[model samples]
Target: MLMSPTVRSGTLVMLIALLRSPATTVAVPPPSSVQASAIGADVTAGKHLFERHCAVCHGIEGKGGRGPGLNRAQLAHAPDDTALKSVISDGISPDMPAGWFLTDEDVANLAAYVRSFSNIPSEPLPGDAVRGAGVYAKGGCSNCHIVAGAGFGYGPELSNIGIRRSAPYIRKAIVKPGATMPEGFLLVEAITPSGDKIEGIRVNEDTFSIQIKDATGQFHSLRKQDLKELQKLRGESPMPSYGGVFNTSELDDLVAYLASLRGKQ
Candidate 1:
């Protein structure tokens, strides 16, 4: 059951206080202790249990569905195995509920299973970044995407995209731009009373008002009541897909160049 707003506020206040209480807070449990506890724990049993219980939100492989992927970087909340074990047992408020029904050994087993996916993996690209830069320029990639301030202030900045996203993800984004529209970049078509239609990617929105930036780099601010029609297009980007634009080798070169862009222009 969800907590009432009043109860939630009080709980949040208490949590903040506890987080700030250096003297009252207990020491972080050691990863070694968690490992020792799970030395004889059945990982296969844990996987089965996880699929039955946690797979809906977190994928069967812990790759994330409704929740963040477990197979990524170190978890921000639970930095170590000891902390993770506690989180699994107690759970976080609001989003995660306490696992009071789970036995200590069961929680330990889950923790062990979860721990196995924390390794970060990277694939090496075969194409040359130098040649890829030329292809990027020819394809007018910089017109919308900014790499070290080379392009217009439209679309997503790609200066540090190499560090932010994986190579495979980048390739998918290029081939299918509208497949997964990014957050805060949802395409919206707003029509005014006099049959004036404004199509743009939303910048910000609230219950009362919305702000959108058009392809022409113009920002439109309008009240909810003023708009005759407001449509939100999910999984849609303004950028055209490069599915047929680039050949097989050029695509590989472009991806390679993008992957090589750690931070430079």
Candidate 2:
């Protein structure tokens, strides 16, 4: 393996130890030097442990996916081993899924792995935003969309969209927009006195009735209890398919441009 000259000797040793005996149980020495040595050892162990367990979901560098970006300030001051163990064991609420599957040792190593992200700088997306700007303009993306705080208000703004969504999700959104429809585009239904049902994307609602936008952009207003079946289905986007819209290279470039938006703080 081509090792970086900057890698501390202690870190390299730890890497070798991990590669040699990944399953071996060992006591982690407490930080005593209060210097670069401790940081290097922890980071090296973290790198290997992360590669073994978290790389698939969080990327090799922990950028994100099935998990949030660990490098971000959101987790900067998260508690130490005890607190981290709970989080790793119980997990954060809402958006984050449970992490109870991890063993105590796994959690410990994983916490150290997460801490490594804080030391390394995030790699920027390798693409020309300038080129992406042209592609965005000529590709007719703004016809019903927006980018970087500008463009039509009909579609949700794409500014900083790269941060909230992953590259794969973004690609999926563009290629098959109908798959993961955004919120607010959900179809709502109401029952009528005659036992009839009507449904469409609810644009507005009051105690008595609701306004809806259908596939054709046509709006319909209906009164409450005027029909049967009132279900909110945020399924399928109305955006057109982008298959063969651009060559593979263009797609790659577009993704790179989007990824580049994940800037460092």
Candidate 3:
């Protein structure tokens, strides 16, 4: 669900404090202690599990790349254990590889690491509708995500995002992208003989030239003929899927804030 961007400024301080607490690991378990069980899982150990098995794809802290960021607020609010384990074991469709490689114990460790980023409470953020309006303007969300009849032209419009998406799902999309990245939004790069380089959203391409649209809506027509090199990659987005980027509460506020954006202005 898209969360409301409007948080009361007063609530922000309290939410931040709560987010930093050790007990904040809600919906998900506390960081499991590796010594607690023969399973030997803890956030630290889970970090190792992530690096050895997951980092190459998911990134060191699950900020996402070839994989998706795991540190999403949505995962915190969703159904527990069963849903998580299933995804871990079965994997997200298409992009994510199945987690059959992981032992159940290892999966648990991984879950802990992923869950460590959540606020762990059933309560939604104390968002202020009035404040959210300002956030929407300040956060530069319109630069990528369009909402209602306004905003930028780069990303999928959020006209009815609150209706179509859930809070957790929205959060996941922000932090971890590769798992269900919408196609056609792939970034492309080209290098010219003059040593000029360019990159943007791939619009259209052939043997001769490719088209790309940058954030500002400027289109660059890159000539394949004069290009010294051309490269296309499928990986994490330049958009920092905020894993470590946003605190759990800020994410919650953002989500709540976006959710509120549904309907008329």
Best by TM-score: 1
The TM-score of candidate 3 is 0.46
Compared with the true structure, what per-residue lDDT tens digits does model 2 show for residues 1-265?
Answer: 2134387877677764664374632444464322222332344555676786667656777877534456653452254545655766675543344566666556665675676565556556555666766677777877666666667644555665565556666667677777745544555666656675655567888888788765445677877666455666556454677767976667766766665554331
User: For model 1, how does the per-residue alpha-carbon lDDT over 38-88 read when each residue is reduced to its tens digit?
Assistant: 444445567777897777656788765434456745665567767877887
Q: After superposition, how far is residue 91 of candidate 1 from its true place, in Å?
A: 16
Question: Model 2, stretches more than 4 Å misplaced?
Answer: 1-63, 66-112, 117-127, 181-223, 227-234, 262-265
Between 2 and 3, whose TM-score is larger?
2
Q: lDDT tens string, model 3, 126-245?
A: 655456556567666777777767878676676755534455566677677655455455777778798877776788888888997776778988778888888886774656566666
Against the true structure, what is each candidate's TM-score?
0.58, 0.51, 0.46
- Relative to the unseen true structure, what is the C-alpha lDDT of residue 141 in candidate 3, on a scale of 0 to 100? 71
Top-down TM-score ranking: 1, 2, 3
At residue 163, give the lDDT of candidate 1. Answer: 48
Model 3 lDDT vs. the true structure?
0.61
Whole-model Cα lDDT of every candidate shown, in order:
0.71, 0.59, 0.61
